[model samples]
Target chain A: MTNFPDIASIRKDFPILNEVIGGKQLVYFDNAATTQKPRIVLDALSGYYEHYNANIHRGIHHLAEKATGAFEDTRRRMQKFINAPLSEEVIFTYGTTDSINLVAQSYGRKFLKEGDEIIISTMEHHSNIVPWQMLCEEKGCVLRVIPINDEGELLMDEYEKMLSGKTKIVSVVHASNALGTINPVSDIIKKAHKVGAKVLLDGAQASSHLFLDVQALDVDFYALSLHKIYGPTGMGILYGKKELLDAMPPYRGGGEMIKEVTFEKTTYNELPYKFEAGTPNIADVVAAKYALDYVDTLGKDNIAKYESELLKYATDAVREIPGLKIIGQAKDKVSVLSFVIEGMHHQDIAVILDNQGIAVRTGHHCTQPLMSRLGILGTTRASFAVYNTIEEIDSLIKGLHKAKKMLG
Target chain B: MTIKEAQDELIEDFELFDDWESKYEYIIDLGKQFPPLEEQFKTEENIIKGCQSRVWLNAYMDGELLKFEADSDAIIVRGLVSMLVKVLSGHTPEEIASADLYFMERIGLHQHLAQTRSNGLASMLKQMRTYGIAYQAAE
Candidate 1:
């Protein structure tokens, strides 16, 4: 069993922990869906909306300038946060879905042709899947998916076999949202590069928990959602190698995204703005810095250590509960734990847990294809964050006992 | 004037039945209360994509008032339309434009909904708001 994290001081930072749900203190385990915002993030959002409520880049006024400075500051902060090569490589988009769509629309449209293949793992979220499917359908490209083993780890042999001269792009998630499997992305990147295929790592789940240095990994592209990292909704960042980013065409055409526009001829803006077409979720983007800072303050290693302990505790506790089967037992994993009771419906379990003020994500988790591969409808997923405590896991264990007694 | 008033109406109507199942039965019955929309409104343009239940929504501006006609393939979802119409219909463009949606939470309608269903409701509301904006811009 791993050592329990120092969570007493951490819990004090989150005011929402004091909230009561169904007459019980909320035991929020759905950190994968979206994390609870800390006071720093909330304050940053309020500070922006109340004080610097103006659009960026174009305006020459005071608040506009302040907003513009704050916005670009986030780009630089994100660059250092992920250790990107440069700020220009960072494209602010609307979460992971939008980031993947941007890549598929711009890069896939520009580079991929008929009979060219794109590879992805079976563990990819639907966000990663649908965009490629749309591109493949539009361009006549073939989408070749790398299958995973029963443990939810990518089959490297299959992946190696799939990579050839026909392969153009390989997109895969760095960590599984439903299964918590930490994919061996560095090795995957090296292999893909040897085959001359560009790689895009969906870092949505890994951004908050793992140490991400895009340059060190030499990953072609990386996409992450700020909301899942304890930031506001409707914001995400995409990091690409400068050459590839510059070569890609513009995603959306509008005022901020163009240098010049005529009815007949239009010239797009440079790098990041080429993908970001209109006024963004300015408040959220500025406030995301606070979320990043919050993570930095706690240190990802320390947080991971604490969460690993919690996962082991929960895993061992649930093992004693008869008829509970833990899914995704990959040797290397993050803090997510997913399972199914022998005879209980996932939704029924969720309802009962919610009644006891525990929140766990129950369903396919936008990985219906993965669910099909696993031969199950869905599993109840409880993902951990920095602020989650072992006591919460104890509550979950108690709740499960109640659930088994009531249902079994 | 507020969602509370509408919720009071819902509760009164709910009292005419018992439990969520019978309330749902009443809601489906109320869906039958709406006039069948003209067949032309059933075109692809009116269909709301990404809904688990197939739903069609069409709206037009009658003077300064915005009128909407909606339908759904699912009985349960059509009941949602019934709730929306009672709260949304026969109001001025501005009134329908500025109505508070957090009231749905107060009534606990959205509190129990699946995320996708909640998203669909939000999309339906946004579509209604867009209709108002289009009419206002035209005027």
Candidate 2:
């Protein structure tokens, strides 16, 4: 009945929203970790398995052709979704962690050398941080960190000062998972490129909430986890500039990654296949297209607009609660409200919320370094998506009030 | 009580709550039963390696019984640790080493434990059991 993208109908599409826990309807606020897959994306997964399940890109069979077509269809879809320069630039991997590891192992190992410096930020997930650290350790490179201010925004002036000839690569998260800070990756990319460093933006958090355009961002590399974007788990994409991907060596050397194999020398497959070794996640890849379509159908602009409202509402509501403090108040952010109660532990708050069937993520959220940087162990995180309604936010507020009475 | 008896007692305790809300609240309440781990026991060796929060567990043998003192930065995990200590401690080394945690699944608490946290929990139990086995062998 009401306009503003018909949130109720959209909520119904997510079947898990109907889950009754503790005699209450499920209120999912953990979108930053992973999103609930819609029925359409689910159907595509089963339909692929039901009709045409086969190893992609080799067989002359009909099912193979259909599957190969559908699987490749997702690559093109992702290319369009992010407005990449070429479909060949889209390389499928396990998830963001795999994608980051690919860049670190293949490109980083090949190019980076002793005394070289790589710049990362305090807010990166461990997946992003560890791979680079491993690469740095092997290559004898120095890892430089971009410091953040009290508000969780990156210190741009400090980042600018750090840019020099020794800086070989600058990798950072586009949006912080813990803080919800929308980083100025465009500026970071530009400055790093000026210093001759190839920039890799960890787009795992941003891809779900913000409009992504690799071409527009002109990033050397960008990693996305499809599960964070409402697609199935175990599937994601690594979007690299065509030239960089071509220049980088194969990540994993196995089947479907080589053209000719012999005892003497082997020729690697071109573009994406070089990185995506072995049999790819064919079923999940095919369904990922429908996930993108669902996002496109709802419209990112619309989703952002709606989610922003929810964020604002929840922020206001939580402020009214006694002894609660919001964290990560960046000037630009995406719909995530991280907070801490004065005396209550994050897990206690999380458990109490779970009791009320209002699920919110608690603890470090895989960003322990960020938590340490902020001088706190962790915060109870409530993130909003397109399907979330104000009513749900009210329930969260009410639940927190009860938590205050019990735990405070 | 036997380890099995302790687990059965926990299952009965959880069975009193029909909904996950009350069950979780009761679990949180149980955290208070755990005496905080001694400052000396909070050293790096006793810390669990993976987490959204830090958990420290220390084990020692008194006669045949293995006593565990544990603490967590997160209260809910602290509650879980308290329950584990209740069920696993005060048992003979062989009994502690061989105890099967069937009550975890029976009480439906297994579903609430994340794969990572469960792995950490499993590791904590393993550390305790390994300690018991080592002490038993030493004796």
Candidate 1 segments whose C-alpha is farther than 4 A from its true place = A1-6, B1-139
Error of 2 at B25 (Å): 4.9
Candidate 1 lDDT tens digits, A246-319 = 99998787878998988899998887888888898899999999889988888888877877888888888889
The per-prediction tally of clashing pairs is 0, 0
Q: Write the per-residue lDDT of candidate 2 for residues B55-135, one digit (tens) a residue.
A: 789888777677888888767778888888899888888888788878878887775444466226666767888887887
Query: What lDDT score is found at residue A132 in candidate 1?
Result: 99
Candidate 1: pairs in clash: none
Can you give the lDDT of residue A294 in candidate 1? 86
Error of 1 at A139 (Å): 0.8
What DockQ do the predictions score, one after another?
0.04, 0.52
Which docking category, incorrect, acceptable, medium or high, applies to candidate 1? Answer: incorrect
- Candidate 1: residue A243 Cα off by (Å): 0.3
> lDDT (0-100) at residue B79 of candidate 1?
63
Candidate 2 — which pairs collide?
A: none
lDDT of 1 by residue, B1-139 (tens): 4544675677566666544434544555675566666788988999774323356888876766778888764444556776776677666776667766544564456743445552255567678878766666776
